[model samples]
Target: MTDRIQEFFRQRRAEGRDLGPCLVVDLDVIRDNYGAFAKALPDTRVFYAVKANPQPAVLDLLARLGSCFDTASVVEIQQVLATGCTPDRVSFGNTIKKERDIARAYELGIRLFAVDSEAEVEKIARAAPGSKVFCRILCDGAGAEWPLSRKFGCVPELAVGVLEHAHRLGLVAYGISFHVGSQQRNPRMWDGALKSSAAIFRDLAERGIHLSMVNLGGGFPTKYLRDVPAVKAYGQSIFRSLRKHFGNRIPETIIEPGRGMVGNAGVIEAEVVLISKKSADDQVKWVYLDIGKFNGLAETMDEMIRYPIRTAVDGDEMEPCVIAGPTCDSVDVLYEKQPYLLPVSLEIGAKVLIEGTGAYTTTYSAVEFNGFPPLETHVI
Candidate 1:
């Protein structure tokens, strides 16, 4: 958390305007993050994933910084364009899309698309003829907090056929892509994916279809409760893997960073709604906030993402507590399998600060769920 965001919360409370849970994002932090990614991988392009956080201010800032965009839908493409960014700088990175959406994106001047199946290739060829198409392969998602595996990407052997089919159907077989996973902590994970990509590139070259780029899909992690490696470390490791696999002919490369780009730039301020225990002999207290899975903190599902929660009573006597949300749904629990440690003095009406939440919170928030408004966002 930064001083500016703290001051914002303090002022909101002072004015009695802190009526609900809200997210505050520091634009200065985003600007610095963009610079860091650009500096670390100087040769690679940065495509800010729109799905992570599609705030208009965030898009406008990244556009001015010369960052490209990776959009998942036609609406996202339109959102990026509304920022005065040209369509050429945007990639339709979602492998699964409606044919109409492909036609719409093509009409909007989006020539680059992602595909993992011949059926998808056919749809693109019919709707977006001669567009550049990259094939995504599956990874095991070994070390990521949010593993993105089965829903997207084809096998490497199948990707060859998919790209070749695209070539025959009048589409440009651009290159290969794969996501190691989201919130990936290990820098070495890129090596195995790069190796597979190199093999695909070579196989296609023999068939007279040379590829030109490698979409190093987003897996870069942001600091949460556990510390993560620096972006420079990932960049260095990826560069080394590129050299190892492709020798001197490293293909033109790009990275789609979602969490790593803006995750640390935001914080959430929530109010402790109630604090109670289930039984007289219970040692754990249930602390409920106004926000929950249906409202904002969906990433806490399956207890995969553990957010750092801070309150004024921190640094006092601490104990394990079951953190929950104010909603009536039984699934509104935030942390239960692994109880969160909070100060024993924490009480109702206390304001809590949740850090490392800029990327996923606002976008994941539900609309009017349990009559709670969506997570309010302020880009400072």
Candidate 2:
């Protein structure tokens, strides 16, 4: 906590104003994270998943840092283009195919794509003839703690069939891909996915469909509130396995990192709305902030497990408090039972800050249920 953040808080406090559960981005932290990924995964084209946080400033920073774009929809493609990314540098990485979305991306000169089914192959070939594509395989089915097998992710056996169909359509079936689920806290997950990739490449050879690229969908580990697997080491171990199994026949690698790049670089600042306790016997002190689940940080409302949070209370009194948000929804709780400190004797109206709202906080939110305007954006 440098004066950079502290100064921002201090300035408003002096002006008789408090930050109202506002989200802030730190360009320095983001740049360092991006640089670390680029350095670790040498020669691999890095596409910072745009859906994570498509703030104009965030995208602009990515472009300036030489990171590519991984977008899943037509509008996402348009947003990447808006951030000045060249078409070839962007991949429409979602396996679900929308005819109009494919056409739209093709119109923007998007070359690389990903798909998981025969229906997708038909639509892509019909809409964008000769487009290069990646067949996405389902790693762990949706029945796990998190299930993504619902709409996309072809099974490994089905992947061979899909690749065969792709080759027949005269479209360039460049390679195969698979996302190993998100918020992955374990390095072993990569081992499972990369091993599957090796098997797929060999199967593709047996089926006569050679690929030119291998898209390993992002989920390259990030620690939130708890220690998770290390990102750089996990990525390297997987890369080593891919090379070992496939030799030089391994296609060029591509990755899409969202939270790993921006998760730690942002924080939220909210106003203290209410502070009270349950009852005489129940001594769980609660402090409510103006920022609600829908407003300040919707990630939690959606049950998004973020990093362990550290709090900043306006005054210098440090005591444990149950921090909540201002949403009308009863389920609008943000952080509970987590050790958060507020000044011992705080005023009725105080301000609080929560860390790590960079990834899924802004772009994927519905913040204006009551006509509340979005907060202003600054590049500091």
Per-residue CA lDDT of candidate 1, range 229-307, in tens?
9999999999999999999999999999999999999999999999999999998999999888887899999999999
The residue-level lDDT of candidate 1 at 163 comes to 96
Report lDDT (Cα) of residue 53, candidate 1: 96
Q: Given candidate 1, what's the lDDT at residue 303?
A: 92
Residue lDDT tens for model 2, 1-380: 33466666667668965545566678888898888888878878888898888888888889988989999799888887897878988999888767988988898898888888988898888888898988887777321223344466877888778878878997887888887776665555656666777787788877777777778777764556656666678667767777777777767988898888887777666666788888876556787877656664666644456444444435466777776766566776766746465677675575555666677777554547555445433446
Could you tell me the TM-score of candidate 2?
0.88
What's the lDDT of the predicted structure labeled candidate 2? Answer: 0.73
- Number of the top lDDT candidate: 1
**Where is model 1 poorest over a 10-residue stretch in terms of lDDT?**
363-372
Query: Model 2, residue 241: what's the lDDT?
Result: 74
Model 2: residues with Cα > 4 Å off, grouped in runs: 1-3, 12-19, 141-151, 302-304, 312-322, 336-347, 370-376
Instruction: For each candidate in the order shown, give its overall lDDT on alpha carbons.
Output: 0.95, 0.73
